[model samples]
Target: MERTLLIKNMVCDRCKTTVLELLKTEGFKVQSVALGEVVVKDASKKDDIRLKTALQAIGFELIQEEADVLVEKMKLALIKQMDKGDADFILSKIAEDLGKHYSFLSKTFSQLEGITLEKYLINLKIEKVKEYIQLKQLNFSEIAYSLNYKSSSHLAKQFKSITGMSMTAYKKLQESDRKGLDKIV
Candidate 1:
Protein backbone atom coordinates (compact mmCIF):
# COMPACT_ATOMS: atom_id res chain seq x y z
CA MET A 1 0.00 0.00 0.00
CA GLU A 2 1.05 3.56 -0.60
CA ARG A 3 1.71 5.38 2.66
CA THR A 4 2.17 9.04 3.41
CA LEU A 5 4.52 10.13 6.19
CA LEU A 6 4.22 13.51 7.84
CA ILE A 7 7.67 14.78 8.58
CA LYS A 8 8.46 17.56 11.01
CA ASN A 9 11.19 20.12 10.19
CA MET A 10 11.09 19.34 6.47
CA VAL A 11 10.92 23.04 5.82
CA CYS A 12 12.97 23.99 2.76
CA ASP A 13 14.22 22.77 -0.62
CA ARG A 14 17.42 21.58 1.03
CA CYS A 15 15.44 19.83 3.74
CA LYS A 16 13.36 18.09 1.12
CA THR A 17 16.47 17.09 -0.78
CA THR A 18 18.05 15.70 2.36
CA VAL A 19 14.96 13.71 3.23
CA LEU A 20 14.70 12.38 -0.32
CA GLU A 21 18.32 11.35 -0.33
CA LEU A 22 18.06 9.76 3.08
CA LEU A 23 14.98 7.81 2.09
CA LYS A 24 16.69 6.58 -1.03
CA THR A 25 19.85 5.68 0.87
CA GLU A 26 17.82 3.73 3.41
CA GLY A 27 16.20 1.69 0.64
CA PHE A 28 12.83 3.38 0.65
CA LYS A 29 11.31 4.60 -2.59
CA VAL A 30 10.23 8.16 -2.07
CA GLN A 31 7.19 8.63 -4.22
CA SER A 32 7.28 12.34 -3.40
CA VAL A 33 8.80 14.66 -0.83
CA ALA A 34 7.34 18.06 -0.05
CA LEU A 35 7.76 20.52 2.81
CA GLY A 36 6.24 18.34 5.52
CA GLU A 37 5.39 15.05 3.93
CA VAL A 38 6.64 12.07 1.98
CA VAL A 39 4.79 9.28 0.25
CA VAL A 40 6.22 5.85 -0.23
CA LYS A 41 4.81 3.40 -2.76
CA ASP A 42 5.61 0.22 -0.88
CA ALA A 43 3.92 -1.36 2.11
CA SER A 44 5.19 -2.71 5.39
CA LYS A 45 5.08 -2.27 9.18
CA LYS A 46 8.79 -3.09 9.32
CA ASP A 47 9.65 -0.10 7.19
CA ASP A 48 8.04 2.17 9.76
CA ILE A 49 10.47 1.36 12.58
CA ARG A 50 13.50 1.40 10.33
CA LEU A 51 12.50 4.62 8.64
CA LYS A 52 11.69 6.26 11.96
CA THR A 53 15.10 5.39 13.35
CA ALA A 54 16.89 6.49 10.22
CA LEU A 55 14.98 9.75 10.03
CA GLN A 56 15.60 10.52 13.68
CA ALA A 57 19.29 9.98 13.24
CA ILE A 58 19.28 12.75 10.65
CA GLY A 59 17.34 15.29 12.81
CA PHE A 60 14.00 14.68 11.14
CA GLU A 61 10.88 13.13 12.68
CA LEU A 62 7.91 11.05 11.60
CA ILE A 63 4.55 12.29 12.84
CA GLN A 64 2.21 9.41 13.68
CA GLU A 65 -0.51 10.92 15.79
CA GLU A 66 -3.76 11.86 14.06
CA ALA A 67 -3.99 15.36 15.53
CA ASP A 68 -0.38 16.14 14.78
CA VAL A 69 -0.89 14.85 11.28
CA LEU A 70 -3.70 17.36 10.93
CA VAL A 71 -1.55 20.09 12.44
CA GLU A 72 1.22 19.37 9.96
CA LYS A 73 -1.31 19.44 7.19
CA MET A 74 -2.43 22.88 8.31
CA LYS A 75 1.17 24.06 8.56
CA LEU A 76 2.08 22.68 5.13
CA ALA A 77 -0.94 24.27 3.52
CA LEU A 78 0.01 27.62 5.04
CA ILE A 79 3.64 27.27 4.03
CA LYS A 80 2.69 26.34 0.50
CA GLN A 81 0.48 29.40 0.28
CA MET A 82 3.23 31.66 1.59
CA ASP A 83 5.84 30.23 -0.75
CA LYS A 84 3.54 30.81 -3.69
CA GLY A 85 3.27 34.51 -2.69
CA ASP A 86 -0.40 33.85 -2.16
CA ALA A 87 -0.17 34.45 1.62
CA ASP A 88 -1.88 37.76 1.11
CA PHE A 89 -5.10 35.82 1.37
CA ILE A 90 -7.24 35.25 4.48
CA LEU A 91 -6.98 32.44 7.05
CA SER A 92 -10.59 31.45 6.61
CA LYS A 93 -9.91 31.14 2.93
CA ILE A 94 -6.86 29.05 3.63
CA ALA A 95 -8.90 26.83 5.89
CA GLU A 96 -11.51 26.55 3.18
CA ASP A 97 -8.82 25.62 0.73
CA LEU A 98 -7.73 22.90 3.13
CA GLY A 99 -11.40 21.80 3.25
CA LYS A 100 -11.78 22.47 6.96
CA HIS A 101 -13.88 25.08 8.70
CA TYR A 102 -12.13 28.14 10.02
CA SER A 103 -13.30 27.48 13.60
CA PHE A 104 -11.94 23.94 13.77
CA LEU A 105 -8.64 24.91 12.21
CA SER A 106 -8.23 27.88 14.50
CA LYS A 107 -9.08 25.97 17.66
CA THR A 108 -7.02 22.92 16.82
CA PHE A 109 -4.05 24.94 15.66
CA SER A 110 -4.06 27.02 18.82
CA GLN A 111 -4.55 24.08 21.14
CA LEU A 112 -1.73 22.06 19.63
CA GLU A 113 0.68 24.75 18.51
CA GLY A 114 0.20 27.03 21.54
CA ILE A 115 -0.32 30.02 19.29
CA THR A 116 -3.21 31.37 17.32
CA LEU A 117 -3.35 30.85 13.59
CA GLU A 118 -3.39 34.57 12.96
CA LYS A 119 -0.26 34.99 15.02
CA TYR A 120 1.48 32.18 13.15
CA LEU A 121 0.47 33.64 9.80
CA ILE A 122 1.73 37.04 10.81
CA ASN A 123 5.05 35.52 11.85
CA LEU A 124 5.34 33.90 8.44
CA LYS A 125 4.51 37.18 6.72
CA ILE A 126 7.05 39.05 8.79
CA GLU A 127 9.73 36.56 7.83
CA LYS A 128 8.84 37.05 4.17
CA VAL A 129 8.85 40.79 4.69
CA LYS A 130 12.35 40.57 6.09
CA GLU A 131 13.41 38.62 3.02
CA TYR A 132 12.03 41.31 0.78
CA ILE A 133 13.72 43.99 2.80
CA GLN A 134 17.01 42.16 2.58
CA LEU A 135 16.56 41.74 -1.15
CA LYS A 136 16.08 45.55 -1.37
CA GLN A 137 14.14 45.13 -4.58
CA LEU A 138 10.82 46.47 -3.34
CA ASN A 139 10.09 49.53 -1.31
CA PHE A 140 7.92 49.34 1.78
CA SER A 141 4.73 50.31 -0.01
CA GLU A 142 5.34 47.85 -2.80
CA ILE A 143 6.30 45.12 -0.38
CA ALA A 144 3.22 45.85 1.65
CA TYR A 145 1.09 45.62 -1.43
CA SER A 146 2.78 42.44 -2.55
CA LEU A 147 2.07 40.85 0.80
CA ASN A 148 -1.58 42.03 0.61
CA TYR A 149 -1.69 44.54 3.43
CA LYS A 150 -4.15 47.38 3.20
CA SER A 151 -1.43 50.00 3.34
CA SER A 152 2.21 50.46 4.19
CA SER A 153 1.33 51.94 7.55
CA HIS A 154 -0.68 48.90 8.48
CA LEU A 155 2.14 46.70 7.46
CA ALA A 156 4.56 48.76 9.49
CA LYS A 157 2.37 48.53 12.54
CA GLN A 158 2.15 44.76 12.34
CA PHE A 159 5.83 44.44 11.52
CA LYS A 160 6.89 46.52 14.47
CA SER A 161 4.56 44.60 16.71
CA ILE A 162 6.19 41.34 15.77
CA THR A 163 9.84 42.34 15.45
CA GLY A 164 9.97 45.09 18.11
CA MET A 165 11.61 47.27 15.49
CA SER A 166 10.56 49.42 12.59
CA MET A 167 11.47 48.67 9.03
CA THR A 168 14.07 51.39 9.11
CA ALA A 169 15.58 49.90 12.24
CA TYR A 170 15.59 46.43 10.73
CA LYS A 171 17.27 47.78 7.63
CA LYS A 172 20.05 49.38 9.62
CA LEU A 173 20.76 46.19 11.49
CA GLN A 174 23.94 44.32 10.53
CA GLU A 175 22.18 41.05 9.83
CA SER A 176 18.92 39.79 8.46
CA ASP A 177 16.21 38.75 10.91
CA ARG A 178 14.63 36.37 8.46
CA LYS A 179 13.80 32.79 9.31
CA GLY A 180 13.07 29.90 7.02
CA LEU A 181 9.42 29.47 6.17
CA ASP A 182 9.34 26.16 8.03
CA LYS A 183 10.77 27.75 11.16
CA ILE A 184 8.36 30.65 11.50
CA VAL A 185 6.41 29.18 14.38
Candidate 2:
Protein backbone atom coordinates (compact mmCIF):
# COMPACT_ATOMS: atom_id res chain seq x y z
CA MET A 1 0.00 0.00 0.00
CA GLU A 2 1.15 3.50 -0.61
CA ARG A 3 2.47 5.19 2.50
CA THR A 4 3.39 8.74 3.34
CA LEU A 5 6.49 9.25 5.42
CA LEU A 6 7.03 12.60 7.12
CA ILE A 7 10.69 13.49 7.18
CA LYS A 8 12.63 16.01 9.20
CA ASN A 9 15.38 18.26 7.73
CA MET A 10 14.00 17.81 4.25
CA VAL A 11 13.90 21.56 3.99
CA CYS A 12 15.41 22.33 0.56
CA ASP A 13 15.62 20.98 -2.95
CA ARG A 14 18.99 19.37 -2.26
CA CYS A 15 17.45 17.53 0.67
CA LYS A 16 14.58 16.38 -1.55
CA THR A 17 17.03 15.06 -4.14
CA THR A 18 18.94 13.14 -1.49
CA VAL A 19 15.73 11.55 -0.24
CA LEU A 20 14.67 10.59 -3.77
CA GLU A 21 18.04 8.99 -4.31
CA LEU A 22 17.87 7.15 -1.01
CA LEU A 23 14.41 5.78 -1.75
CA LYS A 24 15.39 4.78 -5.26
CA THR A 25 18.54 3.06 -4.04
CA GLU A 26 16.50 1.18 -1.45
CA GLY A 27 14.22 -0.19 -4.21
CA PHE A 28 11.12 1.86 -3.45
CA LYS A 29 9.42 3.91 -6.13
CA VAL A 30 9.13 7.42 -4.83
CA GLN A 31 5.87 8.97 -5.91
CA SER A 32 6.63 12.45 -4.66
CA VAL A 33 8.62 14.44 -2.12
CA ALA A 34 8.08 17.81 -0.51
CA LEU A 35 9.49 19.52 2.54
CA GLY A 36 8.56 16.83 5.07
CA GLU A 37 7.05 14.00 3.03
CA VAL A 38 7.96 11.11 0.84
CA VAL A 39 5.05 9.30 -0.81
CA VAL A 40 5.90 5.79 -1.76
CA LYS A 41 4.06 3.55 -4.20
CA ASP A 42 4.04 0.56 -1.87
CA ALA A 43 5.86 0.03 1.38
CA SER A 44 5.70 -2.61 4.10
CA LYS A 45 6.78 -2.54 7.73
CA LYS A 46 10.16 -3.97 6.84
CA ASP A 47 10.63 -1.31 4.23
CA ASP A 48 9.55 1.34 6.69
CA ILE A 49 12.08 0.20 9.24
CA ARG A 50 14.86 0.14 6.70
CA LEU A 51 13.90 3.52 5.35
CA LYS A 52 13.82 4.95 8.88
CA THR A 53 17.28 3.61 9.59
CA ALA A 54 18.70 4.89 6.31
CA LEU A 55 17.21 8.32 6.90
CA GLN A 56 18.64 8.49 10.42
CA ALA A 57 22.05 7.55 9.15
CA ILE A 58 21.86 10.52 6.79
CA GLY A 59 20.85 12.89 9.62
CA PHE A 60 17.21 12.92 8.60
CA GLU A 61 14.21 11.52 10.52
CA LEU A 62 11.02 9.82 9.56
CA ILE A 63 8.05 11.07 11.57
CA GLN A 64 5.04 8.77 11.74
CA GLU A 65 1.72 10.33 12.61
CA GLU A 66 -1.83 9.11 12.25
CA ALA A 67 -3.72 11.35 14.65
CA ASP A 68 -1.69 14.50 14.04
CA VAL A 69 -0.98 14.09 10.34
CA LEU A 70 -2.99 17.14 9.41
CA VAL A 71 -1.13 19.24 11.95
CA GLU A 72 2.18 18.06 10.59
CA LYS A 73 0.98 18.69 7.06
CA MET A 74 0.10 22.22 8.07
CA LYS A 75 3.55 22.80 9.49
CA LEU A 76 5.18 21.51 6.32
CA ALA A 77 2.93 23.68 4.22
CA LEU A 78 3.91 26.74 6.23
CA ILE A 79 7.58 25.92 5.90
CA LYS A 80 7.28 25.45 2.16
CA GLN A 81 5.46 28.73 1.85
CA MET A 82 8.17 30.53 3.76
CA ASP A 83 10.87 28.93 1.69
CA LYS A 84 9.32 29.98 -1.61
CA GLY A 85 7.50 33.21 -1.04
CA ASP A 86 8.67 36.71 -0.35
CA ALA A 87 8.78 37.66 3.31
CA ASP A 88 5.64 39.79 3.19
CA PHE A 89 3.04 37.10 2.57
CA ILE A 90 -0.24 37.78 4.29
CA LEU A 91 -1.48 35.35 6.93
CA SER A 92 -4.97 35.68 5.54
CA LYS A 93 -3.63 34.56 2.19
CA ILE A 94 -2.01 31.54 3.78
CA ALA A 95 -5.24 30.66 5.59
CA GLU A 96 -7.22 30.88 2.37
CA ASP A 97 -4.69 28.78 0.53
CA LEU A 98 -4.74 26.09 3.22
CA GLY A 99 -8.57 25.82 3.04
CA LYS A 100 -9.12 25.93 6.80
CA HIS A 101 -10.21 28.47 9.35
CA TYR A 102 -7.16 30.39 10.54
CA SER A 103 -8.12 30.18 14.20
CA PHE A 104 -8.63 26.42 14.06
CA LEU A 105 -5.35 25.89 12.22
CA SER A 106 -3.53 28.13 14.67
CA LYS A 107 -4.95 26.34 17.73
CA THR A 108 -4.25 22.88 16.33
CA PHE A 109 -0.73 23.92 15.31
CA SER A 110 -0.01 25.33 18.78
CA GLN A 111 -1.32 22.19 20.45
CA LEU A 112 0.78 19.93 18.28
CA GLU A 113 3.99 21.97 17.92
CA GLY A 114 3.99 23.81 21.26
CA ILE A 115 4.10 27.18 19.56
CA THR A 116 1.49 29.45 18.07
CA LEU A 117 1.31 29.70 14.30
CA GLU A 118 2.20 33.39 14.43
CA LYS A 119 5.27 32.62 16.47
CA TYR A 120 6.23 29.87 14.08
CA LEU A 121 5.75 32.16 11.13
CA ILE A 122 7.78 34.80 12.87
CA ASN A 123 10.55 32.35 13.50
CA LEU A 124 10.61 31.33 9.88
CA LYS A 125 10.39 34.92 8.73
CA ILE A 126 13.21 36.01 10.99
CA GLU A 127 15.38 33.31 9.54
CA LYS A 128 14.62 34.51 6.06
CA VAL A 129 15.18 38.07 7.18
CA LYS A 130 18.58 37.14 8.51
CA GLU A 131 19.40 35.49 5.21
CA TYR A 132 18.41 38.60 3.33
CA ILE A 133 20.42 40.81 5.66
CA GLN A 134 23.46 38.64 5.22
CA LEU A 135 23.18 38.86 1.49
CA LYS A 136 23.55 42.65 1.89
CA GLN A 137 21.46 43.25 -1.17
CA LEU A 138 18.32 44.66 0.41
CA ASN A 139 17.97 47.72 2.59
CA PHE A 140 15.86 47.63 5.77
CA SER A 141 12.88 49.29 4.07
CA GLU A 142 13.04 46.78 1.26
CA ILE A 143 13.45 43.87 3.64
CA ALA A 144 10.48 45.04 5.68
CA TYR A 145 8.36 45.39 2.58
CA SER A 146 9.50 42.11 1.07
CA LEU A 147 8.69 40.35 4.31
CA ASN A 148 5.25 42.01 4.32
CA TYR A 149 5.84 44.06 7.42
CA LYS A 150 3.82 47.25 7.68
CA SER A 151 6.99 49.33 7.93
CA SER A 152 10.63 49.25 8.84
CA SER A 153 9.71 50.20 12.39
CA HIS A 154 7.34 47.25 12.66
CA LEU A 155 9.92 44.84 11.32
CA ALA A 156 12.53 46.24 13.68
CA LYS A 157 10.28 45.80 16.67
CA GLN A 158 9.41 42.19 15.82
CA PHE A 159 13.03 41.36 15.02
CA LYS A 160 14.19 42.79 18.34
CA SER A 161 11.46 41.01 20.25
CA ILE A 162 12.43 37.67 18.81
CA THR A 163 16.24 38.00 18.62
CA GLY A 164 16.93 40.36 21.53
CA MET A 165 18.91 42.61 19.22
CA SER A 166 18.22 45.36 16.74
CA MET A 167 18.57 44.51 13.09
CA THR A 168 21.70 46.64 12.93
CA ALA A 169 23.13 44.90 15.95
CA TYR A 170 22.36 41.54 14.45
CA LYS A 171 23.96 42.48 11.16
CA LYS A 172 27.11 43.58 12.92
CA LEU A 173 27.51 40.25 14.70
CA GLN A 174 29.86 37.73 13.13
CA GLU A 175 28.11 35.67 10.46
CA SER A 176 29.48 32.41 11.87
CA ASP A 177 27.78 33.09 15.20
CA ARG A 178 24.32 33.78 13.78
CA LYS A 179 21.50 31.73 15.28
CA GLY A 180 19.96 28.95 13.27
CA LEU A 181 16.34 27.79 13.22
CA ASP A 182 16.98 25.24 15.97
CA LYS A 183 18.41 27.99 18.16
CA ILE A 184 15.36 30.21 17.81
CA VAL A 185 13.19 28.43 20.38
| Top candidate by lDDT | 1
Error of 1 at 12 (Å): 2.2
- Tens digits of per-residue lDDT for model 2, 8-97: 767678888998999999999888888778889878877878988999998787777642655666656666677776555566665687
lDDT of 2 at 149: 88
Q: TM-score for each prediction?
A: 0.92, 0.83
Give the whole-model CA lDDT for all candidates, comma-separated.
0.85, 0.77
Q: Which ten residues in a row have the lowest lDDT in candidate 2?
A: 176-185
In Å, residue 175's CA in model 1 sits off its true spot by 1.2
